[model samples]
Target chain A: DARVTQTPRHKVTEMGQEVTMRCQPILGHNTVFWYRQTMMQGLELLAYFRNRAPLDDSGMPKDRFSAEMPDATLATLKIQPSEPRDSAVYFCASGLTADGKGAADTQYFGPGTRLTVL
Target chain B: DQQVKQNSPSLSVQEGRISILNCDYTNSMFDYFLWYKKYPAEGPTFLISISSIKDKNEDGRFTVFLNKSAKHLSLHIVPSQPGDSAVYFCASGYKAAGNKLTFGGGTRVLVKP
Candidate 1:
């Protein structure tokens, strides 16, 4: 089965450290998304890419968080000078852009990377 | 503001019984809704979905009911099995709004076999 793959299923890092999470979207999928899930905030969209170009990153912390799709198969989410508040399960999802439009997007999520910031 | 809400944090149901999970949304622009099931340490898996144009949609043992007027939708799993025990999340989306899904906090369902 074609599935989104994520790296470092679990990670523990100290505050102020740099954390990087990688994802391999399902082959042929054209859109990728990054999300953060916490007990208090639920699920929040951190960033998204369409055709390997960022469509939105408004939900991310502009100063410390960045997301990129270095190639068709790889997408990455990075946090610099990470803080305790950044500790959460980060999920990566990919979907096909139906009919060349943004409609009918059905996302399939990866196993998610659990980040623990001490 | 939380656009989607799953008020019940958890529920328990006997095997072979019907398990109903409810969700409500405050966003009037949402045109599509979906249900997802998640196991511990796993990503949410797609369960079922309903569009605003239709009040009901079904797939096998799962059914999704939508009440657009009330901004509420529900997932019904008939003849619940032990494998149905998982966290359920409700997500809402607007096709015109880039299809970005807004998800609820999720409800944990336990099926006693």
Candidate 2:
């Protein structure tokens, strides 16, 4: 069975440290999404890429957070000088779209990376 | 402003009973809705989905009902099992947008055996 895989299932870093989370989307999936889950905010989309191209990152903090799909197989989210408020579970999800399947498509998520910034 | 809202933060139900989770949305652009279930320490998984054109969709023990006029949707799980304890999230999105969803605050359900 195909699944999305995320590295660093757990991370504890001091504030102001740079944290990088990696995700390997299921092979053959064309779209990748990055989401953050927090107690106060619930689950929110940070950014997403379609076919290795950045589609939208409006929900992400451009000053400190950056999401990129260096290639089709690898998608990365990096936070420079990460702060305490950045502590949350970061989830990477992949889905098959681009064929106009739009709303009918379902996203397959990876075991999220739990980030704890002190 | 949260376009999608799950008013109930938690629900408790006995095993073999019916569990209902409701979600309401304020976005008129959303023509499609979906439900996702998340277990502790795990990512949310797709549960069920319904389009504005359809009033209801059913799969196995899970049923999703959509009310476009009321801008509401609900998920029904019959004969709930202990394993059904998890967080359920309701999401809405536009058909024109490809797979990007606006999610509501999840409801934590506890199924007592």
**Which pairs of residues clash in candidate 2, taking residues 3 or more apart in a chain or in different chains?**
none
Give one digit per residue, the lDDT tens place, for model 2 in B75-96: 9999899999999999988867
Writing each residue's lDDT as its tens digit, candidate 2 over A57-108 gives: 9999999999999889999999998999999999999998857445436788
| Number of the top-ranking candidate, with lDDT as the measure | 2
Q: Fraction of true contacts kept, per model?
A: 0.49, 0.67
Tens digits of lDDT, candidate 1, B1-113: 88999999999999999999999999999988999899999998888888899999999999999999999999999989999999999999887756578899999999999
lDDT of each residue in A21-93, candidate 1, tens digit only: 9999999998899999899877898998888999889999999999999999999999999999999999999
* DockQ, each predicted model: 0.67, 0.69
TM-score per model (chain B): 0.98, 0.97
Q: Which stretches of candidate 1 lie over 4 Å from their true place?
A: none
How big is the positional error of residue B32 in model 1, measured in Å on the Cα after superposition? 1.2
